[model samples]
Target: MAYESSVPYRAGTEGYTSFRIPAVVRARSGHLLAFAEGRVSSAADSGTIDLVLKRSADAGRTWGPLQVVARNGTGTAGNPAPVVLDSGRVLLLQVRNAADATEDRIRRGHVPPADGRRIWLQHSDDDGASWSPPREITGQAKLPHWRWYATGPGHALQLRHGPYAGRLLVPANHSTPPTDPQDSGAEPRYNGGHALLSDDDGATWRIGYTDSDSDTDTGRSVAPNETTAAELPDGSVYLNARNEAAAAWQRVDAVSTDGGEHLVRPFRPQAGLSGPAVQGSALHLGDRGALLFSGPAHPSARALMTLRTSRDGGLTWRTAHTVGGLPAAYSDLVRLDRDTVGLLYETGDFSAYSTITFRRIPVEEPT
Candidate 1:
């Protein structure tokens, strides 16, 4: 099969002025769900953004109309991180903030009650048809010191091995040192990443693991932000994170064996895989038992959307193909079948945020 593309979101349409942060997932019901941040005001990250979705029942040839699954009015309700249980139920984890609080205010520790950046969740028992109202889980999922926090801008995962086989892992990120004691006049940098574990199928949540500043000592800082995850055969959870530390923000990888509470080893940079400080995703292709990562490959730019494969469970990766030389940014990978995969991302000719799109890729090895 060839790679076919579709535009599901665009600037100035359907009451939304722009859209960004695309995430896709295939439910057990054999339906494709595409999600994006419907920025109702402008292309900026902050504003009245909602978690919007579209469903594709016929593989990838077509998609349903736009539906607002989660919204917070003028407030922020975005970064859709969805996971499908083995029971065919889809659970979504997302972040929310007050209408007046911008990213800057939250990262600086100037937070407000019931209005600060917090975590919320919703579930759809009927595939992608209807969603339950969002319920906050910030008390259990978020720490008191964490300010700028967000769930997977991509997708969550389901453990397939060990005692945590049925657990749901929500890849997430947050900034640390909620206070700037030194009075440094700079933007608050996201320090690391963590995973929220749901053992009872999205009922209760807890922090699995937190990436620390130990890796940042490598010449420059290394903040693991906007993470992606996959499970290995040995029951280890692998995280591919966006290093938003310096100009050359390379990607990093880590693994956890104990339900994401502790790391087997500190994060190591995936020097070969590169991209701008942006979100990406990872998917475990069944049958072949290989891992696939999707994101921009350019060092200083966010174009040249690249697809990579790892046979050894994320230890190393090789470029399988470049989706295109088009302007692309954030992307998420989803398995359509044993041999068919899908990529939902932001792509356009001039700007990456101009459109949120979808594409189907051949998942088998390239000859």
Candidate 2:
């Protein structure tokens, strides 16, 4: 099915500058809000990276003005995952890079302060119109002593029709060590990749999966990139990850049936089209178990920023269609109704951070 693309979303100067790493969700009130890392100015202070937002009132038919949600210089106001809590409030779990402003640690692998790039949450009482002050997920405020840096890719979801009904599960990306031996420590090699779960919405978190003890044993840290998740029919939570070992292109899977309590093994590679640079969102579309992914559809080279659909979970995929003609990075998708799908991606030259593009994608049944 060839879905026609519409130019409903675009980046603005203030909050939409060179937008990259996008996350979108249809709020409880049928409102669609797309969030991205907004680059405001070109100056050093401009280097301050923040999470900007755009709202779509008419089912993604169009978008509203841009607004800033979170910011930290060159340090990235990374990806955000929105989950309408059991209490009807919308809570966003996001990553913030505090040390991104320092010129000294640009490329030298300056170990991010303990809490270098940390996870925080912003709650909205009025359907994203106004948000409360950002609060760090974990209250341990010693900063550098926090030890963990860069934790996110959080997709908070509630268990539907399951034993754990109301409990909120936040599958977030984190840099940590593994617990089980059978599990692969592929993350440590690449410095990170793991998921953390929070029972009390975004208040407290527990490690779902991580690397093994020995560094040499763990080949690559499978950083779960801009990944979205879904609960399988059997009550297992399947997390789609962009393993750094696979160059962030290949999609990895983590399964936890008892909610997000503990993940079994690390992950295995699927045979579809992930390459050197791929970041995506995986959605369980319909009855055929259709899994739709939005990411850099770089089959060989990072060229096509596209959307691909698979009849089976992640086994096989049909030829994808590009959302925007240019380079598309860190794309996200939401199910408007069963048939309609809304997509948001960072468009423009990812190499130089030129511009961010957002759009409305209408999915249709293949003829």
Candidate 3:
């Protein structure tokens, strides 16, 4: 059977104007939260991307109005992913650009002070109605670094059995020390991705394995983008990371036996949905035995047309099934119980019609 979907949430600027690029999650209180990088213009202003958040309480059946989590004057404020702390508290994770604080100093090139890349947290004690003050958890204040963003189309899962058993796992890309200019070519250059584990719920954090400087094998420098982790029954971690090598990004799976202390080198010709310069998601669903990979199945994959599923732990994949008729990319999937799976994707065309939308499907259905 094909995957079924519904558009429970969508946001437009002034008059149905699309400003989309989002991340989704299922809160502990059974509410659905979809967050996106609300852009004022079509292109990257790098200074004005805000975190636009919306919620659904009725299991993706309907949604609430759009709410602003954070905003930068002209810089970006995004990487909207949600993590339900062990204490049952829901934390919204995001990165905000400190525009006014760094614009002039960075422009003057006076050693280019790192643009503010602070990690912020918004806590919802009573569901999504109201939130606590956004706190900067990245303690790189003294450093000249400007950004500490985590653009996780991937959801954060808590470590179950280990020394750091209670810590939250978050995957992110480093925006500091922007690519080396001396080495330039047709290749793509950017900061690598890493993980941050929080012990005191959302109060504090300690970072985990960061990516290597570069990978010549993949033809470009290697770095992690959206990385999702699942704890096996034996407690070993299965990490599926979005690898950006060359210009295109592909999903690669790695296994960590020592509780994420280290991961084996990921296998190649990676087994999930990917395309040239595109993003995909790999989620552990249905009692830890099933995996849901959602993205463009073809290299030319565009829109929200393709989604694939693998039941036996990424060893093989069935043919892709379309979730929505729209151009879908940057999606998140999580099992909403046993049989239900919740999804949120950007809907619309290349130039316009952007919206962070929500949909759902069953676990036993065919891909």
| Cα displacement (Å) at residue 143, model 2 | 12
Evaluate model 1: give its lDDT.
Answer: 0.83
| TM, every model | 0.94, 0.79, 0.81
| Two-way lDDT contest, 2 vs 3, winner | 3
Q: Kindly list the per-residue Cα lDDT of model 1 for residues 1-367, writing each as its tens digit.
A: 2578788888889999898888888878788998888988888778899989999898867888999998898888888899889899899899998877887877666667568888999999988899998898999998887778889888888898897799999989888652446753356675778889888998898898887553433564567888999888778888988887755547888889887888888676777677776788888876688888999987778898999988888877898878988789999998888777889888888988788888888876643
Error of 1 at 110 (Å): 2.9
Residue 131, model 1, lDDT: 93
- CA lDDT of each candidate? 0.83, 0.59, 0.60
* Candidate 2 lDDT tens digits, 1-367: 3443443334455544355556777788888777766655532322556777778788876678777777654466665777777666788877665544332231123444442556677889777888989887654311232233443343457666477666666555433433344533232333334455656766665655453222545554344543456766556666676665554336676666677666666565655756445556776655546667777766555556777887655657775556655665566677788667776655655541344445556665753
| Candidates in descending TM-score order | 1, 3, 2
Worst ten-residue run, lDDT, model 1? Answer: 212-221
lDDT of 2: 0.59
TM-score (C-alpha, index-matched) for candidate 2: 0.79
What ranges in model 1 sit over 4 Å off? Answer: 178-180, 184-186, 214-220
**Clash-forming residue pairs, model 1:** 208-260, 208-261
